[model samples]
Target: MKIKTLIVDDEPHAIEIIETYVGNFPEIELVATCNSAIEAFQILQKDRIDLLFLDIKMPGLLGTELVRTLKNPPKVIFTTAYQDYALEGFDLNAVDYLLKPIPFNRFLKAMEKVFDGYRPINRQIVSVQTDQNKSENFIYLRVDRKTVKINVRDIYWLESLKDYIKVVLADRTLVSKQKISVLAELLPESLFLRIHRSFIVAVDKIDSYHSYAIEILGKELPIGRNYKDACRQRLQN
Candidate 1:
């Protein structure tokens, strides 16, 4: 799917470079270009901008402020020369942050984030599929044709095997040959979250979290290198 995007940066050369790079991707279509956040905001009000390539430093307003001002902002990817704003970017759930003087490969990664901005493709988009036919809170585990019904609440944590996942519960671990990404959606969002590419854990099930791992039922699970901050914040709350 083509992503309609906007570029908002103070530097004319920076905007030119971005426009040139964005032209390289078949999936990306530049919708608007603005030198300031206010101009971008006006454009956003009139156009359907799907993604934003925002710059941190600008004359009247900072890029982060522009994002905060929007009631329903599009997906944002902060573009800046300084690496200091990385924490702020993630706090806003930015798709990805692009360092200034963006190389083609790095730009490619940012473009790929279009996939990440939304839900993982396999899981159905949440909707009002309610009432008599409410979505079941259980997933069927293929246990040799005798499918076992596993309640989402019972899942404490899951570890990735070479070809499957070991669903760790208080009682016992059940084996699931499902991708962690897909299984993530099957569970309740408030209860479970993907702390790593390989691990999924119940938010409420966490007993104590440390700098390295979270201790659950005396079992410690390694926090994925990049996902530590998000997990720590969530666990603390």
Candidate 2:
């Protein structure tokens, strides 16, 4: 019933603040407080941590790098003094990003997200068969005043239409009044690529690519100049 948690920070004061905040949450149990990423890794190897409060910069291994090494990492709440790492943290699907000096109320808000994300919801589960004919991940979207489950494999591409985004599937399209950037963060980055400012394509759905554009199901999507290099790199390898 308790969420086993770890706090990894180089600063003693930072660790103490997190410890004090953790004490206020009855559902959270602080199992370990590590001063370095190296120590955190060792603890993670032997323990089952439900949540991790990780600091970005450390002496030997940065918190972000340490997280990349894990095959099945726990829900992470990144704590950092600098806002520069926020994008990277989000890309890693972190539970939350806490900027120092962290307020107690802000820390509590982050903990709430951990529960909201990991806790199970009572609903009809949607399924999808992938190219390999195996069942894969599903995402929940709010549509028509209810939460609708959509399989990730069914999504061909996403197009941004100003304030709203069109989720294009094999058979139909669904429109949601959500920012493309926030929606992109919810998707698996390895399976999807932001090929343009207004488009995100499923990498597997891509048929062919050139310097200027990519071909997907007989449609040519122009590769934005700013994203051209990154898109080319992902497509190549």
Candidate 3:
């Protein structure tokens, strides 16, 4: 069953980001987007929305206030720039409270919580595999409006850009909206190494390494002071 979703945010860019992320999930169907709490409240009265991506601060009525008015509210994931509203958002029983400039992976985690409530009876079984069989693994990234699948083996390195990550491939580079930490967690530990706070490199892609830097694709990336010990250990092995 597709989850009927609605996005309510004052900022157009915020709504666009959420919309792009939501589009990647085939299980979710975005119903509408509203710029104000009052506009969203009107839709809630008539439509049966399964999920709501609501922004807390609006001009007139707050997103939290809108939820309070609904006797039978849908599952809500609150999005806001302020951390002060987190306690209040959770007190109202929100599924998740996302801060602005939301990472794609964080948004993905929030959606997973929503899916837990409506788990399918015939869930697909995943086959168990050994570490040696993980070379075929790949991950889907939200690039522009489409989700792009990237093979783990093709990745040369990854560079952190605050809220985004630049994924360096063998032939091309793709900039994705996600935190490097989140991507690091997804990658297989044996094949990838975090060489610095701003960079992660595929172990196999490194041509040479010294005390302070690593050479890959004829370019050098610095090794972070804290990660020097671990980087040396991984590369040496």
What overall lDDT goes with each candidate model? 0.75, 0.81, 0.85
Clashes of each: 0, 0, 0
C-alpha TM-score for every candidate? 0.48, 0.50, 0.58
lDDT of 3 by residue, 42-116 (tens): 999899899999999999999999999999999999999999999999999999999976755567678778879
User: Once superposed on the true structure, which residue ranges of model 1 sit more than 4 Å away at CA?
Assistant: 116-237
* Stretch of 10 with least lDDT, candidate 3: 121-130
Name the regions of candidate 2 deviating beyond 4 angstroms: 118-237
Model 1: number of backbone collisions: 0
lDDT of 1 at 109: 63
RMSD of 3: 8.3
lDDT (10s digit) by residue, model 2, range 151-231:
788999999999778898989888876667656755778799998999999999998889988888798988999999899
Better of 1 and 2 by TM-score: 2
lDDT of 3 at 63: 95
Candidate closest to the true structure, highest lDDT: 3
The TM-score of candidate 2 is: 0.50
Ranking by lDDT: 3, 2, 1
Report the number of the highest-TM-score candidate.
3
Candidate 2 local distance difference test against the native: 0.81
